[model samples]
Target: MRWSSWVLFAAGIATGANAASLTQVTENFGPNPRNVGFYIYVPDKLAVNPPILVNPHWCHGNAQVCYTGSQFATLASQYGFIVIYPDSPNTADKCWDVSSNATLKHDAAR
Candidate 1:
């Protein structure tokens, strides 16, 4: 999808971010050239420069939903860290781009 389309989609999801103690944030890393967007879950309270966890989704799945369903969020809340869920370049599959080095680099570099 185009960058503008992704921005719209990200904005749509971000509407509900402030609903609770756990806030969800959307960030676009398209400037890196692959047009990747990510969802980050941050606890209402955090320590100084908390650590981060990068969670990737499986094929044709949702990364934020997965992270939300896992124990990671709970741990992050308790431990005061950040959890990031990056969307695949191909959202259709939602799979980590393990196809090639360049693809993998794109995923890692973001």
Candidate 2:
């Protein structure tokens, strides 16, 4: 099947009982201290409360670079789920600070 048709089929399977529109929203988790920006996909018709999928970029990778918000967005729209792609706090390498205490605390809070 074509890619478009596949997407439609998947969407139909996702919203088998209830269907809703799709939306993409950008949000910054830590605007004051750490700038952890993320993109969230919200579906319009949710039969039950949607589940969230957190996607973290690779080392030296930015959120925009890692998650293009295309395939995942389409899946979220069809399946009634929320997708979150978080940007790294470090600007130099654009990598998450897995060893830093401060970064750990900030991430835990978020």
Candidate 3:
């Protein structure tokens, strides 16, 4: 649950965002991935020509208002780049061969 802990720590940051839409997109990149939990937010304006970015761990979906992400997201768009945040899978710790984090459960792809 380290990722969730970090998300909780950064909860204060994504409080006052300027964007309009947040989306959780899931695509079957390959037949091998039954569920590749990933998430992204496209600013309200990027409904059509928005950019796509690849970053890890920004929003934990528990934050009511993502204050920390607002400015950074805005800046990324200002620089002609769209920002993307990836949700860590329940198996992030698997690389260490450690016990699973029971709380690290994923909901259906929204």
Candidate 1: clashing pairs of residues: 60-93
Instruction: Candidate 3: list runs displaced more than 4 Å.
Output: 1-20, 27-34, 44-51, 58-70, 91-110
TM-score, every prediction: 0.63, 0.58, 0.39
Candidate 3: residue 33 Cα off by (Å): 2.0
Q: How high is the lDDT of residue 5 in model 2?
A: 42
lDDT of 1 by residue, 25-87 (tens): 445424546656566666655557667677877788776667766887788778877666766
**Superior candidate under TM-score, 1 versus 2:** 1
lDDT of 2 by residue, 5-110 (tens): 4333444443443333232233222233565664444456543656666678898876666556347667766786755566776778887877767666743553
All models: lDDT? 0.61, 0.55, 0.41
Q: For residues 1-110, what per-residue lDDT tens digits would candidate 3 score against the true structure?
A: 36343332222122226343344444333331234354444444433443445555433332113424456566654554455555444454412212344324443232
Best by TM-score: 1
lDDT of 1: 0.61
Of 2 and 3, the candidate ranking higher by TM-score: 2
Ranked candidates (TM-score, high to low): 1, 2, 3
CA deviation > 4 Å runs, candidate 2: 1-32, 104-110
